[model samples]
Target: MTNVAKARESAVAAETRVEKTVLKVLDRLHALNARLVALHGEIKAAQPVSSGSVCLELYPCGPGCAGCPHPRWVKYTWTVETPQKPSVLLSINLDAKERDPVLTLARSTPHYEKTAELIREAKSILLERKKILASIRSLRNSARL
Candidate 1:
């Protein structure tokens, strides 16, 4: 296969991975929302309770973080929501560790926030994949220039 084929394959794989991750993140958000909805019933009069932990942050590892020789870094963290307060980041690290329960979301961790973030990430990966695929197709369709 040519370099173009390799690029297409890699982009396709990356797109799949990003899509799957988005689903997982959305699921976590959904579960947290459900917990809060239930809590709201009993705590209708009590102060809102919330508790969730943050996993970690992502930082650029290379010069630009979006090209070859550079790696995009994601800081892993686990968060659990509390009674009324927002979820708190319990642990954080460079590597992703499934230490804490994810279903629990802190009330503070707004569902919109996580969903938006995941959507943005998924879109970005998909866009990159589209660009690569488009270029390959263009090359295949065009006559020798």
Candidate 2:
């Protein structure tokens, strides 16, 4: 083959390889997007139960109290109900009657588990796409010579 024909063949081969690599990367990205969407849905559907008992201890005589001359302490016990078989208890301390505290519990429920799995799968796909991109870069560099 002439030098010009050889160059044209090499260029076409490189183009084909690059195209294949791009398609593979796109497929992986699509899968990752799907997994993220599913994970988001799972998180949105999760419901947590916030119910427990609260106790208040009042002291009638203290130097800091403006009117009653006493200090009071409040204690709250909270439990989180998960989709799993068991529930967990959360303990909180309240300083004053005017304070209403909000607490969040991060537990592994069924939805959480599914979300975690989807995240893992998405990460794996991302890693795969990264490797493919690296391979394409390597091919392009080699073709430049």
- Prediction 1 TM-score vs. true: 0.31
Candidate achieving the largest TM-score:
2
Which one is best on lDDT? 2
Per-residue error for 3 in candidate 2, Å, reads: 1.4
TM-score per candidate, in order? 0.31, 0.40
Stretches > 4 Å off in candidate 2: 49-104, 108-145
Per-residue lDDT tens digits for candidate 2, residues 1-104, read 99999999999999999789778766765665455455444433443333332222224565642223122223334456568746556445554444432112
Where in model 1 is the C-alpha error above 4 Å? 45-145
Over 90-134, each residue of candidate 1 has an lDDT whose tens digit, in order, gives 434322443322233344554535533443443354345445445
- Model 1 scores a C-alpha lDDT of 0.42
Clashing pairs in 2: 62-69, 62-70
